[model samples]
Target chain A: MKNATITALNHAMATRQPVAFAKNLSDGTEFLLPDPHAPEALNEAGRLALAADKSTTHVLGSESWFIEARNPAPRLVLVGAVHIAQALAPLASMSGFEVILIDPRQGFGNQERFPGANLVNDWPDEALNQLKPDMRTAVVTLTHDPKLDDPALDRALHSNAFYIGALGSRKTHAARLERLSALGHQAESLQRIRGPVGLDIGSVTTPEIALSIIAEIVAVRRGGSLGLRVK
Target chain B: MIDVEDVLSIAASWHGAGEQVAIATVTETWGSSPRPAGSRMAVTTSGKMAGSVSGGCIEGAVAETAQQVMASGVPKLLSFGVTNERAWEVGLACGGKVQVFVEPLI
Candidate 1:
């Protein structure tokens, strides 16, 4: 690898931006794609690689270039350090998400409660403001408290977070929606919230509920449809 | 979920130390391939290897090809799967085919 290529790759990796490394096998020429100054063909190749989230080889005439894409790790942000969160955090982490648990209450956000998990003991709104959820992020509010969950939902809805889910019963969600509507959120924007959060798995336990939530998040992330489950 | 940066850094350091290095990347796969596309493995001229291309099912063959790439300075696009008679010998009996591109780091 040349110094320029290595430097560009290092910068992209550090900044968590998606980039593609392209190499011409025939000529031993290598360069980083998406370079504004590069040829249009190469930039298109980079876009294809990033969109597919896979490495590909493109043959242009007699020239063959291999493009390898490097994408930042996905993130899952939970707005509550409750029991279901304790189960969901590790599950999401194992599923390749950088899990973050936020709660203002020290008793619930302690290390003992969430072993090997990243805990943010600040207020939910403040924590979310600092985090600034992006397209690769999934936000779930499990606190069920208006003070905690509502603020987090507001922040998540305003950001580019791919998935936003809130935990509550249908009646609770209706009341919550009324409150958010009063706060100036449009019905279309509020519809993004997957209230009653999770698939209809008939979950009665904390772990089961957590599983359904994680499953729903994965389904949404991978562009899978939420089909009705057979009994 | 192996970090691609780690593999690239290791390959760069090996090349900086004057050790010939080759990188084998999973370019494509069919059926139930364990590793996805873009998975990589770095191998040195001294037979030391890092990362994985096929989850231990075909590392030996890849490492051998990497050594050949290092010696010849030529890239090789190798394919392995259950259709080959040697697939059973190499433990790729899971009915998947993987295409690996082995190139020397120059």
Candidate 2:
């Protein structure tokens, strides 16, 4: 195996992109398939490894190859440190997401409320700008205040965030969508937002609601059929 | 939080420091293996080591093999399971089978 494959693996790890490393066990030939410098068959296998987030042995004609997947960890960006955020933050963390809570309110977004969390005291827009919601990120806006949620939602829609959610009632979500539309987000793009934000698990309390949202997030992440399971 | 193991970066830095290093990964498992596939252990020829392919079952053997791989620049694939005669040597008596792939960290 060449040092180039290792270099590519470390580079992908640093840049937080998905990559697959294919090794021809027979000859010890190496390829890192972020668009491999190899045959088309290996590319197809690389794609499968990436989609499965798994590493395994595959046969290509005569040679046996091991495909190793290095996928970036999922991230959850909560735009409010409300009661639900308090519950959702830890839940998402436990479920394997780097949770970052953003709230400009010092009192609410403090370490006292979110201990051992990556808290951002900047405005939602500024926070999202620095965060750069990628394909592995899930952004959830829990603050019902239009002033806070709208900007975060706007920034999220403009990016590649896999799951975008907003906490509100059906009526509030309708109004929120209209406001986003006025900001020039097309209807097709705006449709990406899962307003009323959660699986319809009939959650009544803060923790249950947080569970519902995290469940939906996980579903989308795992490509489960229950993804975007809104009422 | 996301579970990012520090072992790979440690190995890379060790290589950067001019140490000869090798990486051992649990590439396959059968039955109830202690670690799943993709678990890794980094080994340097000077007896420096980090991470584990199998929880605690075969670090010593894997590290020894890693050192050999570094010296020869040849990758090695090893398989281990509970065998009646060798069960006392490696304590995977009741556990599952595991295949480890070891190669130099070039």
Candidate 3:
């Protein structure tokens, strides 16, 4: 029987057909395919097909695309090279995200602070024209200046960016919202903004605020609940 | 070549090599988990795995399951509840239930 099974496995490997239930050891467990006497036995294309068949499309809580959804790493565009942004760009890069830092304030957006980041010192809209935020992208405004933040927010609201945030206190956020509303942005459009961004971890320092904001963006991207951090 | 695509390519390469690999993903979270949903960790047949499922809370159990999946060829869904003692033992201190999907890569 073992010999027959082995022979069948060999035939299957050669034919690129899936080997039948040689075994179903356990649920959620990994199993090795038996080696077949074929050149392609070790590099079975059929196995990949089978694995893909078994792979499930799990939607994550993050608003951004799932890890399995795309062929490329998505971009996280930070409009403002603030102290917090200096901390954030590196963090995002290490976490497998492409980080782009934009600021019209040339001195602030220089390489000294945003090393290894795609630095754009143009105004937000003009810079964003090149960056091209997509649905798979995440956008954050750390500039805090209304002139810089507003145009970027306006364009982002119209774009496909999954996570959009603006930095400021609650009062500042309220005022920003009022301005956006006056400009004809609907309630839902304004809702997309994660203003006064980041999780409420009582972050007061640049690094701390950076952590809080990054955590919140991650949470939104993952579809995870804001939970105690928000409250 | 050492870009984000490279990381995913490495993952796909392992999957194609007939290695039993389990992708542990963070599907949802409540409080503070180090890694969130959509974060992937691939486990090799010999009991090594990549990616974080939930900080460090569920790594041990997930790793054990990953080895089994590599050996067994079955996919399983696991959930860790934050309130459970095992949660603390597993590292779900944030009181969130993280759903992990463990499947053999190939």
User: Among these predicted structures, which one has the highest DockQ?
Assistant: 1
CA-lDDT, candidates in order: 0.84, 0.85, 0.65
Candidate 2 per-residue C-alpha lDDT over A22-138 given as tens digits, one digit per residue, 9 for 90 to 100: 877766777888574688999899889888888878889998788887787789999989999988988887776878899999999999988888999999999999999998899
Per-residue accuracy of model 3 over B19-75 as CA lDDT, tens digit each: 545655554555655665545676786665555666576788888887886677666
lDDT of 1 at B81: 78
Better of 2 and 3 by TM-score: 2
In CAPRI terms, where does candidate 1 land?
Answer: acceptable
| For model 2 chain B, the run of ten residues with the poorest summed lDDT | B1-10
Q: Which scores higher on DockQ, 2 or 3?
A: 2
Candidate 2 chain A, run of 10 with poorest lDDT = A1-10
Best by lDDT: 2
In terms of TM-score, which candidate is stronger, 1 or 3?
A: 1
Error of 3 at A176 (Å): 1.8
lDDT pick, better of 2 and 3: 2
lDDT of 3 by residue, A1-231 (tens): 122333443455445454422122132221224336322432243254244433222222321211222224557899988888878887787665778888989889898776667888899988887777886589999877889998888888888898898999899999999988888899988988987888888998888888888788778766788722332
DockQ, each predicted model: 0.31, 0.24, 0.14
Docking class of 3: incorrect
TM-score for all models, in order of appearance:
0.76, 0.65, 0.54
